[model samples]
Target: MPDTRHASISVDQFIPAPPAKVWDALTKPELLARWWAPGDVSAVVGHRFHLQMPGWGSVPCEVLEAEPYERLVYTFNTTWTLTWRLVVEGKGTRLLLEHSGFDLDDKRDRAAFERMGKGWQGTVLPRLAEVAAAEG
Candidate 1:
């Protein structure tokens, strides 16, 4: 028997803002464009959208779940599930991002998983924090 588990990536950040503010930044097109790619993202389930990845072009996505200022789950390029969990802590919020369902058996998928793990931590998360700090 061989291991048959999918690879996943997760990044956690503590934002000095409330869950509502963070939620707005995550869902609003203008705020998201400042940090991540420009997309018509919303908290409505089943709404299709695309994120303009700098060098990768537009990545198709769909909202799978939306729980107001709590949790958001969406699909990424029809390849993986991206989940954002927000929790209120003190006067701030704790954001946990989980990108899962990487097919480890595929070399290209594995490579992408590794690259995204670093990208989320080094680039995406930091930019999101900057936006939150500035806007919150």
Candidate 2:
């Protein structure tokens, strides 16, 4: 059966740091530890991570895949895989992220997908930029 239940959300940011530096922020655990989650929340490979917001309950997550200086892919609830792409542009890096393989038939999971979309925009991407700034 052809899978018809895949969903993807993407966002791009141009960071002032070079691609290598930006990539390090994305791939290095020390850098990720600083900006991978929201507020007092934190993250590590193989750790069950969550992002705490004012209203949203802790959003549970795990790091599914990570490739140094190039790509990172991961799953939440074992349902979707989110991939991040970093490319050198001018003196900085153009970061592109894609979240895929969501189950369309499940409404609750769909809500999570929606939240992931917002989180990337409101939380993760900005934090990545911040990490880039701090990387200097």
Instruction: Give me the candidate number with maximum lDDT.
Output: 1
As a whole number from 0 to 100, the lDDT of residue 7 in candidate 2 is 72
lDDT per residue, candidate 1, 13-108, as tens digits?
888888888998899999999999899998899999999987779999999999999999999886899999999989989999999889988887
lDDT for position 54 in model 2:
41
Stretches off by above 4 angstroms in model 2 are: 38-67
lDDT score for residue 83 of model 2: 74
**TM-score list, all predictions:** 0.93, 0.70
Scored against the true structure, residue 3 in model 1 reaches a CA lDDT of 50
Scanning candidate 1 in windows of ten residues, the lowest lDDT window is: 1-10
Tens-digit lDDT string for candidate 2 (28-66): 557766777352212234655554434556656676556
